[model samples]
Target: MTTNKLEQLKQMTVVVADTGDIDAIREFAPVDATTNPSLLFKAAQLPRYQSVVRGVVDWSKTQGGDINTQLINCSDRLAVDIGAEILKIIPGTISTEVDARASFDTQATLKKAYRLIELYEQSGISSDRILIKIASTWEGIRAAELLEREGIRCNLTLLFSLQQAMACADAGIYLISPFVGRILDWYKADTGRDHYPAAEDPGVVSVKEIFNYYKAHAYDTIVMGASFRNCEEIEQLAGCDRLTISPQLLEQLKQDNAPLIRKLDPARAEAATAKISLQENLFRWSLNENPMATEKLAEGIRNFAADQRKLETLLQQFWR
Candidate 1:
């Protein structure tokens, strides 16, 4: 009997469900799950999560502040509540993101992260099961460094280039989510090409480089490939530490019985290489020089922040 690609992939890589749908989470039974503002915005509109939304709004109202303040509080609670629900299903950690608007503000990001963890604890969820997701901005990286010291693990997201990954490793971050699909999007738009072969795909290639570098250097930070365009991208990264995939692709993988091979191996990875230290100036300059990374990082933050506002607006309807 042949095993489905999904099962095979799970045997190697830690497959993470990248959605806010509880039903999908139950169906796929991923070991881990991740959610961002966009996913939470969509999940908030779902009927099953309506009660969760209402409960959070009700709680926020009792806290007492202006409507804006209440909305902010409610949104944070909703994200945590959804994450808590996800945690109940998965044995692994859930990556709940911080406000993208705070991406460039280290102090504000730290404050928000602390509050998020507190909310989780209030809900009886431990900090160990929560991965605070922050953007890969220099400020965000700085914020994560502080959080890690307090035993708060972070998922450094919106990453594109090696510089961001190196900076995260240097900061002792828990995990880094390299947006595989977005990198491919940039190259397609920039070169006016339709598609690239899976092995040669720019996104796949980028993750491979990051994976190899981290493994070769024996960095403790994990490399989780995120934001995939298709199963091919996931297949190309068969042995990644983790891959947070959307439900649609998860279903596709479940149906296909094709053999899956491990594409990345730490044991077979080349020997350790000389580590490069990335200070603020070099990190900023290198990111500035890489047009794709710079553009995608900014675009990702803007899109996430926009969805966050949208989520708040949706929650506002329950303010009555």
Candidate 2:
């Protein structure tokens, strides 16, 4: 019996479902699941999740705050509620993202992270099983450093460059989600190219570089490749620490029975890259220098913030 690509890929990498859809999560049965504002927004609009949305809104009514505050509270609660639902089906952890609007505010990010964990704890979910997802801004990374010291794991997201990865690792973050598809998007638009082979894909190259650097330096931070554009990108990153693939790509992998080759291996990875002593100024400057990383990082934050606001608007309807 020949194993499908999804099974073969999972043999080497921890496959994570990158969606807020519970049905898709049940179908893919990934070890872990991740949700962002965009995914949560999509899930919130689905008829199946109406009860979850209403429940959060109804619960928010009893919390006693103004409409705006209540909307924020409801959005956060809904994220955790969906995550809690996903947690029931998966044996591993779930990545619930912090509000992207707080990406630059260390204190705000920390507070929101604390509140999210508090909500999860209130739901009888341990902090150990939750990874507070935050953007890879310097402030966010600092916030994560403090949270990690207090036993709160973090997933530094929207990462597009090695500098971001190094900063997260230096902070002892639990994981970093380097956006592969977004990187490819940046390059295609910049260079005006339509397609690139999987092996030579800039996004694939970026993740491989980060993965190799982490493995070579023996950094404990896990590099999870995310935001894949196609199955080829996923196939190329066969042995990453983790890969959070969307359900569409997951289905494609499940249908394809082709041989899945492992392209990344820590044992065979050898890079002479020295450890980066990244301070705030240098980290910011490096990001400023890399146009693709800079643009994509800011764009990612804006997009997530927009979706968060959209989700808030959707929840407002239930407030009445």
Candidate 3:
């Protein structure tokens, strides 16, 4: 039997490819794949996807709308186009993110998510195979709640705190992607330390807490640890519902024949105490108090929004 870490991990949890590269998806063969504006922007630069990018730009030219509207529409189609390609490689689901600039606007986020689904459906992909990725802000959570009721699943991204995770579980979201690497990055920058064993890793600790909370409460919402910095972090959360790993780390896991163990277990979570309820005001305050979560959440949104702009610039060049 193959004993590579990636294969070993699949035994305990669903493995997700956190990228927009079709070649990488084909190579890793993850159960699912996730794409955000950043990944999409980087993928667009690849020569193989140039035609796909041009196709969206050409379609935008035929549409009746202002330049800005056309640009937004084209970018939306571009993201889904990339997702549709990725869906072909992965057997399970593809998480396409909504515009980060709309993170604070529930209605706009809902509409954008709906539009992405519509595009996927038009391509013959069922809504069941699509998970609309959104930021884990209060408004984003509310939008997810509405979308989930309408049969559209959601993957809440940019998650940083237990408050965000609990709120997502409360909303009955299909999945929540708690960023592991970013949390570690925050702590590393603040404390001026770099070395952290898996047990001592702040990122690993956050995901374990969220995973335990979800399993303890028996909430159906899946906890997928995202933005991992190393293989150790991935190995630490071996029994998580899912882990969205980058192509680089996926390759690392593919090569190493290290033994992987289940760090998180449902039975362990079953021993956890009662669940905690969070009101809107309390959720807001809790997030604000966690400086790391607050700063990282804002930074993440800004980075994604910037990537979206870069994508727009690339589209404008092709559109013109």
- Compose the digit string of candidate 1's lDDT tens values, residues 61-126: 999999999999999999999999999889999999999999999999999999999999999999
Model 2 alpha-carbon miss at residue 136, Å: 0.2
Worst 10 residues of 3 by lDDT: 268-277
What is the C-alpha local distance difference test score of each model?
0.95, 0.95, 0.92
lDDT of 3 at 196: 84
Higher-ranked by TM-score: 2 or 3: 2
Error of 3 at 17 (Å): 0.4
Instruction: Give the better candidate number (2 or 3) by lDDT.
Output: 2
**Model 2 Cα lDDT, one tens digit per residue, 185-251:** 9999999999999898999999999999999999999999999999999999999999999999999
The number of clashing residue pairs in model 2 is 0
lDDT of 3: 0.92
Q: Candidate 3 versus the native: TM-score?
A: 0.98
Rank by lDDT, descending? 1, 2, 3
